[model samples]
Target: MATIALPRPVPRYRSSSPIPTLTHSINLDGINTSAACPIPIPNKHLPVCPPGPAPSDKPDTPPASPPTKHLKLQPQSLLYPPTNYKKVTHNSSAVYLIDAAGVAAAVNHISQQPLPEAGQVFPWLHGLHPANHVQQAFFVARRKALRKTPECYRGVTIVKADGNLSCSRLKSAVTTDEFMQTAMAEFKDIDPREGFSVRNFQIQSAKTAMLSDIIVYGEDADEVLRVGSDIAKAQRSRRQGLKALGHEVPVYHTFVCTSHFEEFEEHHPEIVVLDTRGELTGNVLDFFHQERVEMATMTKASEIARNVWLGPTDDLSMSGPSPDDEPFDLFIECSDLGRANVPALKNIVRELDSGAETSQYVEFPSSGSIMPPSWPLTEADDIVESCKWIYNLANGIRPSEDEGEITDIEGDSPMSSPIETRTSRPRKILIYCTDGYTESSMLALAYYMYAHGVTVSEAWLQMHIDKRRNFFAYPSDVALLNSIAPSILSNSPALAHTAPQDVTQRIHDEPAWLALMDGSLPSRILDYMYLGNLGHANNPDLLRAMGIGQLLSVGETAAWTAADIAAWGDENVCVVQGVQDNGVDPLTNEFDRCLAFISMSPYPPSTPSTKLTPPPFRPRPPQWHINPSPLPRRRLAQRHNLHRRSNARAVPLLPTRILLRARAPPQRHHPAASALQLRAAEVGGDDAGEARGAGEEGVGMGRDCERDCGDE
Candidate 1:
């Protein structure tokens, strides 16, 4: 892909320059007008330029008047419509005295009335004419009086059902620290005559002052501690207040609800007051005295004091002590208070007196769960670290700094280069067994090889005799051999089995084994084993004809040695014991031996000689006969003598003593033959005669020989 880059054009701005002025006008009369003329011209037809310099530098300067001409000016109608204006009315009261107008002296009259007192009302009369100004004044005064009335408030608890402190109260309470302090002072005031007095109450005074129970609750109970965190800051001032008064008071803050209170009261009723309201109403002084009461109980403090402390506050002094100080026994959080409360909580702890110990309570609103709501709403990765920190803290475990790094199974860097690359060759193993080989043993052997990364390719069970001529007869022997053989053969290499009738019998007796031996194992089983049975052969009669010794010899010579084949069913059990110790598959080994025998057999070389020989010719026997006529004894004797003579002639002559003396055989035993004969003889005699005859013909025999050989 080709990328095109274009540069953005820069913006240009026009230079600030004054425009040239032009003279313009409209002709109103049939007269030539010059630029200097004082006569007014119509704007539309005014000339823009005269192609010469102006008479005056200023364009607005008036020129001399033109000469008068004897012409009468015609009157023209106004160019625009005239607007009519309406007069506004300003009414004033009129006074009248009827004297002169009635032929008696008549006079207009006016009267003045004295101003009324601040709280007084006007009378009906004291005047000659009624005055509008006094009446208007009275109306204004009445409206002002109404405006001065004070507003009245309807009393109702400002707390919301959802546990949200009224916003109005929160604003007021949070802003007015002086007002709250004054309220607290008033709470502390002891008026004997008014039946209000201070009473000291100790909580678990007999026991060491450790936290017994902490309960927190409120509308914004969760936020209570958070916003009130400043209260911890106020701790030092509070302690100062106590010290100034020569008194010691412990204060614990928490945000717990009724359920938590009940639970705490049940567990530590001695310290946690069950009926908070009862305690509050019974003794106001005692209530304030035990400032360190569990937060749940303290929530029921007198309205004045509760409002002062729990309400919103803007005072910097209210901030809490530092975080390094002991954590509060009970930390109360106001549920309604969001992130803003965190600072408050921190401030409260920071403000605590240097050595003062207190319980902390985190209060959530009635709807809020005790758990911190998931926070830092942003991308998942942004808050992941925070979540991890929170998880560690919640689980009471300290997370290590290196926790985020990735590691391998051995806890080492996985990126390091491997020491060596493994070879791709498949692992192979061969198993040998006999009738004595059990299914369990094969399975075990398979498992062992598999664990070592060696896949067993071939398994063989042999029923052939050992040197002792024992036979394998076990039924399971065939079953086990058949079961594992196919898989081993397919995955690794070829598996072979050799046995005479007994082994064959064991196989034939079991359908599965028979199927395997016949190479007819089902496709489903083949798929399961992941091997196909390619071929099979059996010769029962051959086995019967051949003795066990001869078969063993054949098997051994053919590569199926005793050590390789497993044997069973022997009374002495020598072969079986040997197989057990050696863990060899005798059957497969024997088959391998048979395969080797077939592979390495001398048959091809000996085949033509054995098969092509002609059968021996047999002579017909002479037929016997009897003479029918008895006459002529002398003629019969002569016929007999002729027969005897013919028989003698028929007999062949035999050679007498033959002379036999010979030197070494001639180098050219056949001088008539040529180089071709020598070459033909070297190869074999089958072609020597034809080659010699071709050479004798004297035509190029080489080409003929080559052609003949090619044809052959």
Candidate 2:
């Protein structure tokens, strides 16, 4: 309620006289202000005196000495919490009062009457006076909030009183011109391309069990535009995200949290922030503590970051493929069957030295070195020993790998130093020995990776292209190399004792089977549409990618499920229709079942396949699988009619009935025609061929064959 200014220091002059002292009006709590007088500064020659309330001249009182040269006073409230200053009110009187009676009797007797009651303030009196009681304000400006128990505070800020601090949500966090200018400056460094058109941004929050897809609005325009995101199992997300991004013009910079953000990289401005373990600290906080306290709070702070832009100036422009690249693929021939290893390697070396694209070539176990065993045994560092040889062949640098002297290859031309660079590491590897499908495919995969800085999946794909046929990598071998890829790349000595964990995976799924089937039969054009069983045709995951629906597979007793049909569409994928076929087959005793499943039923199919454009090549499926064979031409004619009834764009119809291939006969022998006719047995072993010929001759002609063949 009041402000007081303290007097400043002034130089004193030597004098023979005493100087009058400064004083103040007295205000008190049960204190006599009349006796409270100022202590005067005395001459150095004056004798020291005993300290008392004040100097007394009355004869009734003994002569009093001066106060101490130094002044010291302590307030009662600082050492105690219950004694803090409080506002006075009529409801409750003061509990205690200050006693200024010591000053009343000694100083000039302005208040000779006994000091007022113990619970009330005394009236003010003029003269030098000391405060009977000291006080402090409820609000502190340049002082601590709570001095006694600082332990109650932690972070940089604390809320002592809860007041109405009103704030409403803003679409953008940044409003001031200063903030935008600084953001633009950062953006300029991030993306030099001008014309600041990008607007929206996506911030992906990691999902937890308790909460998912939770979005919080921020004031800054950049933050408000953000949408949270996903993990790598985002096949569905990628497709949906691609479609969503393409609808609007390029106006937003979306931040997706997924790893495979290849879909967003093409046209839109994309910012990807991968989550790291550094985001959270693994510490425990036991108590609340002030941040500025001597012990300092032990709480961990949150980590955050944003990527303004990621340009391609360094990835390809700075470091890329080259002819003299150091790491190159090496192929070690390990034949499954007995063969001359030395002679075979020598032959390969000769072919390479004659006219290879690069001079960085060396055959394992060089020209004169002895060859090792084919099968690696347990405990003898079997496959491991061979691995070291392969490692040396690839890096050309001895990185303190275990068994050092052995790390040095005893070859006629040991690759001591690798060439500076290599343009393509995977392509450089070509392993062959009698048959390419044996034990070497996986080994070739490992070498391919070392030669080409790529992952196991990439290596497999590269090897697949290299052979353009069957390339078998053992599940065990594949697991071994993949596990050690990091160690090999890091050049760690840990690889020496490392063995493959029981983590190898089998080669399953498409195309792998396609290659294995190709060795005997040369390539044949078969439609990607396959039949034979419902299981193959109705895979939801597979169908979704191809955009092929399951309308033909409908009926309550239908083999496919709703998921199967919806796979080609979104999860809510639906179609409406009504029809049922009751017509019976004239040729067979069965009813005509497929009539309701007509082409262009209910809804149109969204698949990209056209009736004119042939589907992808399916090679061929075997005999027992080709179903109700056409030995009798009558059945073949029926197949021709079924093909005509439906629109040809349907993929399910092409699989089982269409596949046709044979090896024993010069021309193909239809499956049904493979049965024998009994009459030709007397003609001896050649009689079997005659019987087959007779069966083929008995086939009936389909009324529609000529028309279908013409279109084909």
Candidate 3:
């Protein structure tokens, strides 16, 4: 890849263009002042600092004080040299001069250094060095000029070893020779026998061994070791008292034996063996000799020997009769055989080994006898019991009489014979409509019913205006009713009123019947219908049939007026009505049994009006009227007195006095009777005084008047 050069910034000077100097030889103190001369210094002449302590203790001198401040001035640009002023050089002693104008033109120059050879060590190819040779060369040159050591190296080759290669015996079929050759080439300097191996190779010092020192040029080394080990072991075995014929060998270990007959014939053409049966004695020899053996009489003696060594056959059928048909051969039985026969047994182990068959055998301790038996059937019974237990656990009870019944046990249910039984309650539905009034509120009401476990049909609305043209009335207009009523009726037939031909027809319709059905009505509007008759009002056989007892409409001119609702006998009913005015319609029949008398609200419809009249005020009696007749004057006067006493402190003095004179005082105030006496005296002469003095004044006066009249 081509290299990119970064531009250098030029330092400005006041005098005839200052010369460009190496960064280390800039003499910052000299050029920092306005009067300094402009002179270029070659890179080689740059002051170099050696590793040493400074010459100190000559004298203690303070730094010169800064000059007084002057007027601020704009900076001037230095004249930089042209781009072609200097040529690139690879020599360490090469020096280049630059003028002040050329200082700004100084950029990274491409190095002409030759590329490092493969596997060669280069100083630049150290830790985290650049991959490009040009970058490393530039870095080296700059470091040498500045008398600084490069922190990284680059452009070095790495050689990787194959010690870490993983080979699978099952998949890799390379011959031993091929595997060993590959391993030897990878670790040419280190002998495999010495166990010298490389792990996690890294270029610690590129100055000595560059990346080129690391190379992975060969195949897997593990395969080489495995093949070499097998071959060497075989050769050693043959040299150590093991007979070898050509590539084949007869080898025997304590527990196993092998003979490569073909290989022996190929390697040893003169070897001959008249009887391979001589290798074993007694029963072992008999075991091999009883086999159906084949022979090539015309073959070489070496071939015959090789065949006998590597391919000798044995008949295991004659070695012992079937254990099931006869007593096992005691001489060859593993349990009866003595320890001294272990070595001989090992040599003929393959002949005595059992064929593939599975059996469960038990041995008799006293007689050392063995017997095989079939698996038991109790496992199936245990599984059946487990299934029953699980069934009982899940159902909380076991089957009894084939039916479910509550048992005396704390949590168990006794089963009873299957019979028809009802497990759910009948659902009750309420259908309601308003002039498409407060749809959100109505939907919320439906949601509340659902939440409370009440089944409610969708509300049917009767609107009086087109909704599309009047967005404001869209929530409460008749057009919305037209659009949504069909869907509501289709979904909830029990709550729907069939089409009516006339007002009378609708009055007799099922919807009207549903409206009168037994349900909790909003208390504010319940006083117009009888609770007992609500459900059966439209039923022909019911007492209130023909819908006479039902409230047909909820208009302002409905059968029950707001005054009637307000005056209802039930306090719960009236209070609930008052609360419903604020949009709270609680579902409690405790309010009123008269379903039609409830008044949800008396507010006028929300249609836009050109002229709106203020609602008139409603007056309420100061006291409750238990009877139609007015209260007695004396009782009125007493109540008036009580009311006045309640506000005595609030009334003006003059008004209070007039009110006190207008009404008789209460009997409870007899002890403070001065004002009563004064009023009585004004009404009648000394009688008032006599009345005040004598408690029975009226009785004596009546007798005196009667006696005087008798004298006359």
Best by TM-score: 2
TM-score per candidate, chains pooled:
0.11, 0.21, 0.11
Q: Which consecutive 10 residues in model 1 have the weakest lDDT in total?
A: 676-685
Q: Give the CA lDDT, 0 to 100, for residue 643 in model 3.
A: 14
- lDDT by residue for model 2 over 1-712, one digit each (tens)? 0111222346778889887555654456535566666555458967776787554555645676766422222211111221422322211212111112211111122112233221111011100012212111211211233112111111101000111112221111111121112222111112112221111121101101001111112223222222111111121233355457552211111111111222212221111111121111112121111111101111001000010000000112112344443322333334333222333333333334335654222223211111223223241232333433443322232323223312222344433333233211111232332222222344444444443434455444333222222232322344455455553333322222223331122112222222221111111111222111122222233232222333222111223454443343221221111211211112121113222122122223333211121211222222111111111121111111211211111122221111111111111111011011000000000001211111111111121111010011
Find the 10 residues in a row with the least total lDDT in model 2. 678-687
Error (Å) of candidate 2 at residue 137 is 99
Model 2 has an lDDT value of 0.23
Number of backbone collisions per candidate: 90, 20, 46
Q: Which stretches of candidate 2 lie over 4 Å from their true place?
A: 1-331, 338-429, 433-440, 449-561, 569-712
Candidate 1 lDDT, tens digit per residue, 357-446? 443333222111112233223322222232222222222232232342334435453342332321111111111111101101222223
Given candidate 3, what's the lDDT at residue 467?
Answer: 10
Predicted candidate 2: what Cα RMSD to the true structure? Answer: 40.7
Report how far off residue 487 is in candidate 1 (Å).
2.8
